[model samples]
Target: MDKSIEKKYIPLAAYFEAATKDKITLTFSEIETIMGQPLPNASYLNVSWWKKTKPPLKHFTAWTTFGYSVTEIKLGYYVTFEKPTTDSTSSTPDQDSNDHPTYIIRSIELDDARDVIGLYQQLFAETDYMLYGQNENNVSVQSFRKLISKWKVENSGTMLIAIINGEIGGAIAIIGSTIPRKKHCISIKMGVLEKFTNYGIGTALMTEAENWARTRNITRLELSVMKSNQKAISLYQKFGFVIEGERKKSVKIGSNYMDEFYMAKVFD
Candidate 1:
C-alpha cells in the first residue's frame, strides 16, 4: 500500500473533522470531490458497504475517525453523516481551544533507550494490564539499543513515543515480521503514563502507527488486550479495531487467570 493511496482519503477526513453540524449529507460526486478520486465499484453496487458498520471500510476511517457515521446511504447517489446524539460517544479529542495537550510524537532513538525503559517500568507499575509486571522486564539498555538498531535496519517496525513536558509521556510500537509471507501482518503495543491517560496521546500514537503501516504496505495490525482492560479496548475500537477472538486465561496476574481478546484492524 502506497502512502499516496491512503492520503487520497485524508481530505475527506479533514472535511468531516471540521464538521459542526449534527447531521450533514453529501452527494457521491461531492464526496469524490472531497476525496480527489472516483468512487470504487462497490460504492455503487453494494449498499452494505455504505452502512455505518464496525470494522469499517479501509477508506471509511477518513470519516469515522473524526466522529461521523453514515446513517443513511443512497446507492449511486449520496450519504448522510451524523454525529452521535450524545457527545460522550465521540472518541475524538476535545474540540475546545485550550483542551488539546501540548506534546510531540516522534520515533525512538538508541540513546533514548534508558528513558524508554524507565517509561515501561512506570507503566507496568501503574497498571496490571501490560504483558509484563513492574519487575519482570529486565531488558538492559544495551539490548534495547540493539533492538532499536535492528528495527531501523529491518524497516519493518515502528516505535513512536510521545514527548510531553520534556519527558516520555507514552509509547506505541507496531512490530512486523521479516518473513515475506507474513510481512503484511503487524502486532502493536502501546501505553501512556497514568497522568496522561485521557490527553489523546494514545490516539495520536495510534494514528501515527496506522499512517506508518500504510507507507510500509502493512495490512493488518493486531494486539492482545486483557478482557478487563475495557478502556484500552474502547480506544482500539475507536480506531476501527475489532475483537476477532478471545484467549481464555491467557494472562496470569498473581494467581488470577485473566482472559484476553485478540483484536485487529485491517486496511484492504
Candidate 2:
C-alpha cells in the first residue's frame, strides 16, 4: 500500500485547506488544468458519482478532509466548494485558524507501533462504543511491531494512521482472511481519540484503508459498530456500508447490554 499510496489527491486537499473563505468555486477547465487530468464522465451526470464509494474514488476525501464541501459540480464548466451549512453539521475542524490542527495521513510502519498503541489506549478510554473493553488489555509495542511485520508478509492487511501535530489522532486497520472460502472477506477496526472526532480524520483513515483493500481486489469489507454510536454508524453508511444484521445485547457494559450491527460493503 505504501508503494501505491495515492499521491495525486493530496494537492487537491491542500487547495481546499488553504482557502480563506467559506466557499470557493472553480471552472472545469480550471480544475482540469490544475489537476493535470481529465474529469470522469460520470462526474458530469451524477452527483453520487462524486461520493466516496467502495473501491474509493480518488477525489472524494480530498475535498472532504478540509472545510470545503463539493456542493455543485457539473460537466460544462464548474464545481463549487462551500463551508458546510452549519458548524454542528460540519466535518470541519472546530478551532479557529491560529490554533487549528493540521492532519497528516499516511500508512503505518513498524516503528509506529509505540505511538499507535498509546493511541488505542486513549481511544478505548474515551467511550464504551468500541468492541474492546476499556483498559482490559495492555497495548504493547512488541505486539504491534509483530502485527505490522505480518502485514508485510500477507500483503492482505493494511493499517492507515492519521497524525495531528506529531500525535496519533486516529487509526484504522483491515485484517486479512483466515478461512479458505471466505478469503476475499476482511474485517475493519478503527479508533479515534475523542478530541479528534470531528476533524475528518476518520474519513481519511477509512478512505485510505478502503482504497488499499480495493486496489488489492478484496471483495468484502466488514465492521461491527455498537448500535448506540450514531455518528460512527452514519459515517459507515456514508461510505456505502450497509447493515446486514444486528446482534442483540452483543456488548456488555456494567450490568447493561448494548446492541451492535454487522455492516459491510461489497465491491463488484
Q: After superposition, how far is residue 128 of candidate 2 from its true place, in Å?
A: 0.6
Across residues 1-268, which tens digit of lDDT does each residue of candidate 1 receive? 2133266566566566655555667787666644435778888999777763555246777767767778888898888877775765443334423344446566776756887899999999999999999899899999998999999999988688876533677999878999999999999999999988787888989999998999988899999999999999999999999999999999898999999999999898
Candidate 2 residues 122-192, lDDT tens each?
77788788766678868578887888888888776878777664356788888887567777889999988
lDDT of residue 119 for candidate 1: 90
Per model, state how many residue pairs clash. Answer: 0, 1
Alpha-carbon local distance difference test for all models: 0.79, 0.72
Per-candidate TM-score against the hidden true structure: 0.64, 0.64
The pairs that clash in candidate 2 are 28-77
Model 2 Cα shift for residue 46 (angstroms):
55
Clashing pairs in 1: none
**C-alpha lDDT (0 to 100) for residue 232 of candidate 1:** 95
Deviation from native of the Cα of residue 232 in model 1, angstroms: 0.8
Sequence-dependent TM-score of model 2: 0.64
